[model samples]
Target: MQSNHDGKKPGLPEIVEILAVSVCFTYISGGEAVGAVGLLIAYATLRWGRS
Candidate 1:
């Protein structure tokens, strides 16, 4: 069966938004390393959801 999605990848704006939020949380939590890991997980989740 074929999917109905347009197959368009996420744009720069979406990525920037994710990065901005991640950095903000990192600053708030005072742990750059943990924040970076969380960012990667969040980005991966977003990509997986899109696909």
Candidate 2:
């Protein structure tokens, strides 16, 4: 955001654009789902780590 601006404070439009982009990115990437999957994989590995 700060870098997006040319050293000037961003107004409402800039803020909205940034938020919209972030929301879209999170949605497209499945956001917290990836984190949950990673945690599950880690737990399974640790629990069945004898292999």
lDDT of 1 at 4: 40
Error of model 2, residue 12, in angstroms: 0.6
TM-score per prediction, in order, is 0.48, 0.46
Ten-residue stretch with the least lDDT total in model 1? 1-10
What is candidate 1's lDDT per residue for 1-51, written digit by digit as tens? Answer: 433435666567657867786777677768777877677677757754736
Superposed model 1: Cα runs more than 4 Å off: 1-7, 43-51
Report the C-alpha displacement of residue 36, candidate 2, in angstroms. 15
Q: What's the distance in Å from true for residue 11, model 1?
A: 0.5
Query: Measured by C-alpha RMSD in angstroms, how accurate is candidate 2?
Result: 14.5
